[model samples]
Target: MRIASLRQGAAVISEAGAHLLPMPVGDLVTLGLDRALEVGATALASEPVPYAEEDLLLPYRPASVRDFVTFESHVEGVRRSVDNASGVPAAWYDAPTFYFTNPHALYGPGAPIPRPASSRALDFELEVGVVLGAGGTSLTEREAGAAIFGYTIVNDWSARDLQSREMQVGLGPAKGKDFATSLGPWIVTADELPSLDLDCRVSVNGSLVGQDRLSHMNWTFAQMIAYASRDSVVVAGDLLASGTTGGGGCLAELWGRSGQQTPPPLEPGDVVTMEVEGIGSLTASVAVG
Candidate 1:
């Protein structure tokens, strides 16, 4: 089932279209979305509300956010673009590697991402976000798979200049990435989206820029979740993101290799639209600080 958190209330999008549940938006968050779904199932559904009429919010307020780089093509593209000596590290193939991001910085669909005052090289990452249901430490891949609640589109906004400088110190992307991370349209339950193979695409200001298939991922979401849950709890509402897909998924990868100058980095008033086949599309406007 498709679930959306709106400014008005929690809703379920069915073949009949968007039907509001009686539950208040904040109460749905406090009750846990999974449980809210259960309650909404049997309750008298209200009249279908046109989706565009209501203001949407982030489907889940994540307990924590973890993003992983599982696309080998992205890694190779980065190395080639930056002229780095080392390719993807040998240890990367053995285990999935990830970094924690600022959970408080997440934005919903239609939100504006302000270009950090310190950054000029602004970029967007097109990805899929997996939201966990409940799981404990050291989960097996199967266990982790069962713990998944749903999926959503993620646009991990990046400040390439700040990111590159900070990585040189081997510590953080703290200021580089903490500015914004966008998710939504709505969350599609795992049962509704059983396959991971989906077409992912990105466009800026009406022109297509990046496109790739999720089937090409070198590491699966199950593995990423299992690795993340190792010796740590992955509770309901925790978010894990599949990193950018291959091809020209981001400006850093595209311009970095081709030296193309026609399409420039994001500027204020630019609209970024990201779509992953099953989850849906998310669009955000850019604003410079």
Candidate 2:
């Protein structure tokens, strides 16, 4: 069943729509989405309330957010664009690489994303995100796969110029990315979304600018999760992103090929929509702060 965090409490989404329920006593921060999903129908204390996608918030705040770069094509393209001699390194193939992102700053569907005042190069990274169900440490691939509760679309909104500058210092994507990360529409329980062969696409203002398949990721979610859980606990509500797909996943990759002047970075008021088959779509407008 699809679970969503409602204004009043937690909700179980149906084919017809959302059925609101009060969260059991205790803060969701402590209880986590894993326990909520385990409670299942028992959490619904009332009849279904009036609900719409826009009225909902992020399915839940993640306990922690780890985004992985699992796509070789994306890495190759990015490396080739900047330093042609360097390709996907041997270390990258040895293990999946990832970075921790700000979990405090998040947005749900339809939320207006404020343009970072420091960025002239704004872009979007289309990705699939996994939300863990149960808590575990040093989990094997099988154990990690079982811990998964659901999946959602992740719009890892990026400030390209800021990211490039910060990486040069070898310490961060910190302020460059801390502003916002958009999630939701809703979570699709893992059982329901068994296939990884989904089509991924992104459109800006009415044009299809980025399109690819989720199957392009060289490292599977299982490997990424296992690596993340090594000697460390990954509790319920922890988020793990599958990183960007190749074939024009973001403006940095696109602009690198087409030139910054041709397609231009995202401007205020531009509407960006990203979709992954089966999970649903997330759309937001760019607004200047």
Candidate 3:
């Protein structure tokens, strides 16, 4: 069963039909499959359901969100792009790593993305995100699949210069990224996007910026979850984005800003569209004052 957030509330989509449900994004997340069925039946209406698309929203409302950088090529490209001292540390290869962000970033599709007034070099990372189904610790790789609920498109908006300046301390982006990030029109269940292989792309306005397949992640979801569960707990509705892909990913990758001859900074009014093959596209229109 697939669940989606719409303007009216929440809705369940299945072979039988669609029904309006009143469950919050967190509840279905924590409750898992049982809750999904319960809410579906309980919220089923006696009348026929409508099938309009405008009212739909992304299926993310996690208690928290953590996006990881799982592509080695992305790391290498970014290093050269931003003039970093060297490649990612060897520890980064030992296991998966992640950074948290706001789960409230359920910006509706077509929502205009803000151009941070503090930034001159803004970029977007096109990624595939996984939604955890329940709380778990020391989760095994085999068991990790059961903990998944679905997948969605994630755009990790970035301010390149700010990210570079802060990383030397070994922390990160802070205000460099506190601006805005975006996710989803719907969360396609694990069963829905069964195959991990899918084509992904990042386009600026009508021009292509980055395009790659989802198969390139240095660390897979199962591995990340397993590694994460060893020390900390992953709960239902916790989202993990699989980071950016190869070339055409972020501006930091495409144009080596501080290292090579710099390209003209991205002007305000630029629109970025990122899409995954099975899921959907996330479109952001950038603007600055």
**Compared with the true structure, what per-residue lDDT tens digits does model 1 show for residues 97-177?**
888999989999998899998777888998888887676788999988877878889998988778877777777467878
Quote model 3's TM-score.
Answer: 0.87
Candidate 2 lDDT over residue span 1-289, tens digit each = 6677766557777765566655521233245445655655564444666776667777778879998988877777655443332467888888888899999889988888987898887888898998876768889999888777778999998887777777777775777788889998777778788888999999999899889999888877888899998978788778899998888887767655654534678999999999889888889889855
**Which prediction has the highest lDDT against the true structure?**
1
Model 1 poorest 10 in a row by lDDT:
78-87
For model 3, state the Cα shift of residue 108 in Å: 3.0
The residue pairs found clashing in candidate 2 are none
The parts of candidate 3 lying over 4 Å away from their true place are: 13-19, 34-54, 86-88, 104-106, 257-265
Segments of candidate 1 deviating more than 4 angstroms: 22-37, 81-86, 259-262
**RMSD to the native, candidate 2?**
2.7
The lDDT values for all models are 0.80, 0.78, 0.74
Candidates in descending TM-score order? 1, 2, 3
Quote each prediction's TM-score: 0.91, 0.89, 0.87
Show pairs that collide, candidate 3: 210-248
Give the residue spans of candidate 2 off by over 4 A: 24-38, 42-47, 80-86, 259-261
Lowest summed lDDT across 10 adjacent residues in model 3 is found at 256-265
On TM-score, the leading prediction is 1
Model 3 error, position 17 (Å): 9.5
